[model samples]
Target: MSTKEMFLTKLKRVIRTGFFNFWRNGTVSLASVLVMMVTLSVIGLISFSGAILDTSLVELKNKIDINVTFVPGAAEADILNIKQRLESLPEVFLVTYATREETLAAFKERHANDPSILAALDELGENPLGAVLNIKARDPSQYASVAEFLESGNTLSSGGITIIDRINYFQNKTAIDKLSALINAADRLGFALTVFLAVISMIIAFNTIRLTIYIAKDEISVMRLVGASTAYIQGPFVVVGVIYGVVAGVLTLLLFLPITYWLSKVTENFLIGFNIFSYYLHNFLEIAFTIILSGVLIGALSSILAIRKYLKV
Candidate 1:
């Protein structure tokens, strides 16, 4: 036979051997697969949870911002200059200027139905509101720093007089700081837990594959005795691992749909507008591909490691 024909013949034999071993070692294969599925499921659940928490936090942050109120009689030019200064800060996302007249109008609209509030405002006979700067930060952690900048130096003054009378971020400061800390702690804990679980799963998979290799030791020895190469001996086990990976990947993808749907409904019942199901469906292809790739790498690497001890050929 020609060299090309011999290579093709060997390839066909190796593939057949791989399928045969996978079926013959069905119990061991199933155990490894179950372990892999649990691992994949945990990973998917953690990822989904993290995404939901991140979205919720972003929504909360949008509702929390600094309110900078200028003292009565502050010039518009000075306020506008201060707004411009605030806009230059790296942490600032936006700075909106609301004149005293606008503030008065908004207050009146809010209290339009309350005769007592209307009479109180009418008795004042002048606009009692001050020019306010609504400042939004790019990150919650930067709110404190922005507030400090507003209170310090000439940034708040165009003519050397302190234009800013009050910086009202303290009310939400506690919550923002606490939330930032919580997010950091949760991230670290989640990452550590995921790593620990992944390591355990890898160890379990490796031991399972090692046991299968031990069972096939005699067959491997016979192949060696018959002058088979190491690659020929190892190819079947690698194929088995790949099969396990592909199966686990498909199972994980199927499992996430109903799981996320239920989670979405639960979240909406408690706190509307957080839809994990939509996120999962929108990113389904990417999530599925990632799980598949991770499984394949983990399985292939574990099998290679486990088989090395038994495959003397």
Candidate 2:
């Protein structure tokens, strides 16, 4: 046969052999597919959980208050000056200026349902609420620096005005710190879990491929005796492994939709305003690609290792 014909013949044979082995060794193929499916599912759940937690934390941070309230008589111009300075600061994301009137209105709105609070507010007979600069830091960790800048006599009271009052950073400080710590801890744990599970999956896949090879030992030996190349001996089993990986990936994607929908409903309040279903919809392609890539890599590597050991002749 010509060189091109010879190559074509080998390709056809390899494809046929691969399909034949996968069906003929039905039990082994099924087991490998199921094992990979479980691994993929675990990884997917971990990824989804981590994304939700991170997003929820961010939402909490955004809502956190670092109100810099000035003395009741502080001038609107002075408060605007402070707001501008805060806006210029690198650590600050936004600085909202609320006049005493606006602050009182908001306070009354929040307590509108509570007659006692409204009565108390009316009895006070004046807007005791002070002009406020509600500052939002670009990052939670920057809260300390931003608070210090606002409270320092230099940043806000630089115009020799005694218009400054107490800054309310202490009340929200603890929550922000705890959330930052939680995010850090979750990230570390996610990394460790991913590594641990990857190793476990690799081991399982390797053993499954090894078992398949063992079952085909006699056939492999005969092919080797007939001068079949190592590639020829290994091609069929690799094909089986690839098939398992593809099927497992598809199954993982199908399983993820219903599971995530239920989980999102259950954890809606816990996740603040984060909509897990929306997130999945937006990132579906990325998630699917990751699952398929991981499955294929694990499947291909395990098959290669197994065939190397058993077809060493």
Candidate 3:
């Protein structure tokens, strides 16, 4: 036979042997597959959850901004002009202007049960609340600049604006900084745990596969004695590994999709602007490659180790 034909023939024979072995040792193969599926499923879930959390944290950080509360009796025109100027800043992503009346209405709706506060507000006659400008910055760290700009007392017309008394920026700074740090720490911890577990799983799977092949050492020797080539002998185990990988990949995907979907629904508002399903679907190729490559490596390594230790005899 030509070299190509010979290789093809060997490949066919290897596949045939692999399927036969799988059928003959159905219980063991099934057990290995189950273990792999569970292991890979966990890995996939951790990776997906970490990515989701990271994205959410980033969005939250971006939402963090300085709140500029106007002085009561500040001119409506001046407030609008200030808002326009703030919007002109390259660092500003968005500006929301809330009138004093709107602020009071919101507060009343939120605390409708507080009769005393409502009565006190009524006693004051005119609304004592200030128009508040909610300013979101392009960068969280640029909040200081925005605050300074508002409190600079440089651009206001005479008596057109009273300087901002309190920005509420400092109030939120500590909490936002702590949250960002926590998110980063969680991401690192998750990654470390995943890697540690994956290495452990690989070792266990590799040794188990090697032991399984070792149990058939005499058969391998007999085949070699009967003129079997290395390709013919090793091909079946590689096929078995490929089968294991494919099954593990499918099972992991099946288990993860439903759980992720339910989680997305449970935190729909919290995960706003994020699509869990789309994320998984987009990274499916990478996941597939990892699973397949892991299986192949485990299978080949186990086969080589088994042949070295047992087939040599």
Candidate 4:
């Protein structure tokens, strides 16, 4: 046979032998797969953590809207015009108008059980609350621009009188700045934790695979005695390891579906409808790719490590 043909034959033989060993050692293969599944699960949790963190930050930022309270007796038409103008700004995402009546009603409802506050409201006998505009920006960084636009142009009526009593932008400025820093720090921490957990899990998983490989030492020694090349000897075990990873990666993905569903229900009730299961579904493809690739690499690498030590023949 030509050299190319010889190489092809050996490659085919190695693959066949690898598949055969993997199937024949069913119990060992299953154990290796289970170990890998645990590792993949640890890595998969990174996705969940990221989704939860992002959702919480978004909810917080949404709650951080700028409040523009109009002076008492300010005309509703002017307030609505300001709302329209704020909406026109490119940086603004949403501008909601709350009339003085609605604001008073909401306040009264909140203090309904508090007799002292309710009596105080009754004494006023008049709605002192002003109509307000709540403004949200497309991003936290754009909040400054939105606030600046509102202060610069929208505070005064066309009659040149101050219609806006106060803007609560300064009240929330510090929190918004901290939130931006929190987002960056959270992203870095998430990445670092993922890497840390992945490395630790890989170490544990491969050790389990290595132990399984140790049991097949006699088989490896015999193949060496028959003058098998190192690649030929290692190839089958490598394939076996790859199979373990593939199986585990698939199992881990399946496992997360039900787990996230249960967690989603719990969080919805306790955490104001933050659905982790939805996040899982949305990012399933990216998550699957990462887990499966990690499994395959870990399995293949561990198998090679085993071969190096046990293929001492």
Q: For model 2, how does the per-residue alpha-carbon lDDT over 254-294 read when each residue is reduced to its tens digit?
A: 88888778777767777776777777878999999988888
Candidate 2 segments whose C-alpha is farther than 4 A from its true place: 87-93, 105-128, 138-145, 154-161
Candidate 4 weakest ten by summed lDDT: 267-276
Clashes of each: 0, 0, 0, 1
Candidates 1 and 3 compared: the better one by lDDT is 1
lDDT of each: 0.81, 0.81, 0.77, 0.86
lDDT of 4 by residue, 1-313 (tens): 9999999998898888878888888888888898899889988988777777777777777777789999888988888888888888888898888899998999889988999998988899998899988888888778888878877865678788989888898887987778868986887798798879878988988898898888888988998999988898888888888888899999999999999998898877755758888878998999999999989999999999867988775
Error of 2 at 196 (Å): 1.8
Give the true-structure RMSD of model 1.
4.1
Global lDDT of model 2: 0.81
Per-residue alpha-carbon lDDT of candidate 1 for residues 1-313, written as tens digits (9 for 90 to 100): 9999998998888778877877887898888787778777766766776776677667767788899888888999888988888899999999999999998889899989999989988999988889999999998779889988876795646568787778889877887778877977786787788778877876776777677778878887898899878888888888888888888878888988888888888877654577888889998888888788877877778778877876665
Which residues of candidate 4, in runs, are more than 4 Å off?
73-81, 157-161, 176-191, 310-313
lDDT, residue 77, model 3: 82
RMSD list, candidates in order: 4.1, 3.0, 3.2, 2.9
Indicate which candidate wins on lDDT: 4
Global lDDT of model 3: 0.77
- Model 2 RMSD in angstroms: 3.0
How do all models score by TM-score?
0.77, 0.85, 0.83, 0.84
